[model samples]
Target: NNKKGSNLYDYWGTDISDVLNQDESDLIVNLASNEYFKAIDKKTLKANVLNIVFKEKKGETYEVIGIYAKRARGLMVNYIIRNRLTSKELLKDFSDEGYRFNQKLSTGSSWVYLRG
Candidate 1:
């Protein structure tokens, strides 16, 4: 729970689990719907998970999950899923608002990946 934000948090993975619940090995995954990653309005990207990929950490010998795509429009859907520690090195030079608005918008979404 985020007392500052006054709301329940929605972060996933080992880092949060380790620092917040140090002894717990349970992984907290925040699965988003398919449409969440697609282009919509300015507010859409703020509410979805764009993409995920393993990345190396900077100045360290480890890895961390990076969820840095804050918003987008078109080809801007390219997000990196790397170690939280080394994420900045890869995305530091990339702008978050560089995607061209997609011409063919997708609708009527359906369920694909099912997880627990």
Candidate 2:
């Protein structure tokens, strides 16, 4: 994930703190403080996350929703929804650059099938 920058690092730290201990009063008083409450295009968000997953593993599209980044190698991420095809289609395909339109067009398919 290209989420490796100073701004992202700082922003995530702040975001987590705000979410972890938020109360009803905080929610009502500091609506703007809830970064997660900020409007975001769900379609674009899903697409971007899927694109990142596809890059790491070709033909493997993951639907990610919320993500929590801690000061560790592992990140706590959530998926928007679970797709049955992910594991089956991802085992053989490896897209180091993630999923791209060109690749889909060249392959003449949107999602691919593969053997486990």
Candidate 3:
């Protein structure tokens, strides 16, 4: 008998890594769950990853709600697919589901989206 963890990344890491490496485009939009995204070893990937994070504004503070963030992520994927985004610059035009890019809160590799 053989045994392995039930983690998707642990099981399919090589496949994921292969696909990413095959792509000539080195731009990766990582909107996946931390667990699933962890399947690919970044050091092995030929692409540069841009992690998108969603947060909700509450008065003077901001918070990350997993469910809402997940929903927003899905919406963003739909938008990207529908619009056929070819560059990271197009990401700033995302204003769906009441979310927009927060430039002040964003970094070069990590983008932050805020919603009320």
Best by lDDT: 3
User: Which candidate leads in TM-score?
Assistant: 3
Residue range 46-113, candidate 3, lDDT tens digits: 88999999999988988888898899889989999999999998998899988989999999999999
Clashes of each: 8, 7, 0
Q: What is residue 114's positional error in candidate 2, in angstroms?
A: 30
Error of 1 at 111 (Å): 34
Worst 10 residues of 3 by lDDT: 1-10
lDDT tens digits, residue span 1-116, model 2 = 34543555444544444443443321121112124424322322212112121212225642322231111002101121222223323323332223222334224122332211
Candidate with more favorable, higher TM-score: 1 or 3: 3
Q: Arrange candidates by TM-score, highest first: which order?
A: 3, 1, 2
Q: Is candidate 2 or candidate 3 better by lDDT?
A: 3
Q: Estimate each model's TM-score.
A: 0.19, 0.15, 0.89
All candidates: CA RMSD in angstroms? Answer: 17.2, 16.7, 1.9
Which wins on lDDT, candidate 1 or candidate 3? 3
How well does candidate 3 score on lDDT at residue 84?
95
Q: lDDT (CA) for every model shown?
A: 0.29, 0.27, 0.87
lDDT of model 1 at residue 52?
A: 28
Alpha carbon lDDT at 46, candidate 1: 26
